[model samples]
Target chain A: EPEVTQTPSHQVTQMGQEVILRCVPISNHLYFYWYRQILGQKVEFLVSFYNNEISEKSEIFDDQFSVERPDGSNFTLKIRSTKLEDSAMYFCASRGDTEFFHFGNGTRLTVT
Target chain B: AQSVTQLDSHVSVSEGTPVLLRCNYSSSYSPSLFWYVQHPNKGLQLLLKYTSAATLVKGINGFEAEFKKSETSFHLTKPSAHMSDAAEYFCVVSGPTGFQKLVFGTGTRLLVSP
Candidate 1:
């Protein structure tokens, strides 16, 4: 089965540094999403993208966060400035005609 | 709008024993409920989902969930447990419409002991 793939399984960056997490969604998927899971916390939604524009975003997706579909296959989430609290597992997901989503393995971001 | 709640924070069961992970949901519409499992250092894997179809939904890896509308619950169960079954399970809910905007539960950590 085709699946979503993420690069840089683990990322370590100092506080105040910029970080970009990359994902290659399923080829045919039309919608994309970004979610994060803090250690010992629930998975939290950040943003959703369709047609190269953000559809919706949660409060957790603040000024420091941005998403881009730079190419037809690659979707990325960039954090302008990493904070200690930003340490979490970031998951990328894609959706097609159905509402079901295929999630990537996730990028573990450790902002120290 | 939709939300999910995983009742237990942790559940331990011996191998060859039955397993149960409780979950409850609240949705303005007929919610689409799902159970996802995450092993240590691994990504989330879909176990099963209920999209207003048969209440009893069977998923991969010997796992299953029953969506009880009356109880607003979709609890995951397995007849026999294996060491590989140790993982964190998340219950998720999404509104009937939209781009699969999901609300996830805090998750239940299942520990299978041999």
Candidate 2:
């Protein structure tokens, strides 16, 4: 089965540095999403993308966060300036018209 | 607005015993419900989903869920628990007509005791 794939399984960055988390969604999937889970916390939605544009975003997805589909296969999330609170497991997911979603093994971001 | 609520933050069950994880949802329209499991340091795995199809939906790993509209609940159940079943489970809900954003519940952590 085709699955979503993310790069940099784990990352460690300085508090003020910028980082880009990359994902290659399932081939032929139209919708893409990003979600994060703080240690010991529920997974929280960050943003959703379709047609190379953001469909919706949560409060956590502030100005510091931006998503781009720079290429046909790559969906990237960029944090302008990383904060300590930005440290979490970030998961990229994709789904077709159906409700079932395929998630990539998350990228663990650690900012110190 | 749609949301999911997991009644229990943690559940402990013995190996070979039945497993139940209670979940309730609030949605203004017909919703798609799902159950996902996550092992340590891993990503979320879709166990099952209910999209106005059969009320009883079966998923991987011998897990299943019943969608009860009257009760506004989609509870996951398993016939027998295993040590591998010990993980964090999340209840998710999404409206059919909206932006297709999934709302996740505070997860329920299942611990299998031998």
Candidate 3:
């Protein structure tokens, strides 16, 4: 089956550096989303995108965070200034008309 | 708002034995419930989902979940546990409307032993 794919399975960056996590959602999917799971914590929603604009975002998605669909296929989450608390496994998901969301393996971001 | 609670952090079952993972949900309206499994280094896979259609929802890999509105629960069950069933299970909930953001439970780690 076709699936969502994420690049740079693991990323390590300095605390003040900028980092971008990339995802290629299923080709035909419409809605795109980003969620994060801190170690030992519940998965938290970051943002949702449709039609190249953000539909909704959580409080966790603050000024430092931004999402872009630079190309029709690539969805990216960029952090302007990484913080230690930003370290987590970031999952990208997309769904078609169906309610089910298909997720990528996830990008493990380690801010040090 | 919608939320899901997975009762157990971990559950262990022997091969050929039944497997049960408890989950409860809180939703302001009729919620869409789901169970997803994540194996090591793998992406989240939808095991099953409960919309308004049927109370009993059957999923892949011999897994099923029952939606009990009164109990506010959607617990996952399997008649027989297999070694391959070991993984992290997440109970998820979404709003009644179409395609809402999914709220996930902390998750239950299933360990199937020989």
lDDT of 3 by residue, B2-102 (tens): 89889999999999999999999999999899999988877789999998999999999999999999999999999999999999999999876554899
lDDT per residue, candidate 2, B3-101, as tens digits? Answer: 999999999999999999999999989999999999988889989899888999999999999999999999999999999999999999987754597
For residue B52, what is the lDDT in candidate 2?
88
Candidate 2 fnat reads 0.84
Model 1 per-residue lDDT tens digits across residues B11-107: 9999999999999999877988999999999999999999988999999999999999999999999999999999999999986676669889999
Q: Give one digit per residue, the lDDT tens place, for model 2 in A1-112.
A: 8989999999999999999999999989889999999999999999999988999999999999999999899999999999999999999999887666789999999999
* DockQ metric for all predictions: 0.89, 0.84, 0.76
lDDT computed for candidate 2: 0.94
Chain A structural similarity (TM-score) per candidate? 0.99, 0.99, 0.99
The superposed Cα distance between candidate 3 and the true structure at residue B53, in angstroms, equals 1.2
The ten-residue window of minimal lDDT in model 3 chain B covers: B94-103
User: How do the residues A55-79 of candidate 1 rate in per-residue lDDT, one tens digit apiece?
Assistant: 9999999999999999899999999
TM-score of chain A for candidate 1? 0.99
Q: In model 1, which regions exceed 4 Å deviation?
A: none
What tier of docking accuracy does candidate 3 attain?
medium
| lDDT over C-alpha atoms for residue A71 of model 3 | 89
**Model 2 residue A5 lDDT score:** 96
lDDT of 1 at A76: 99
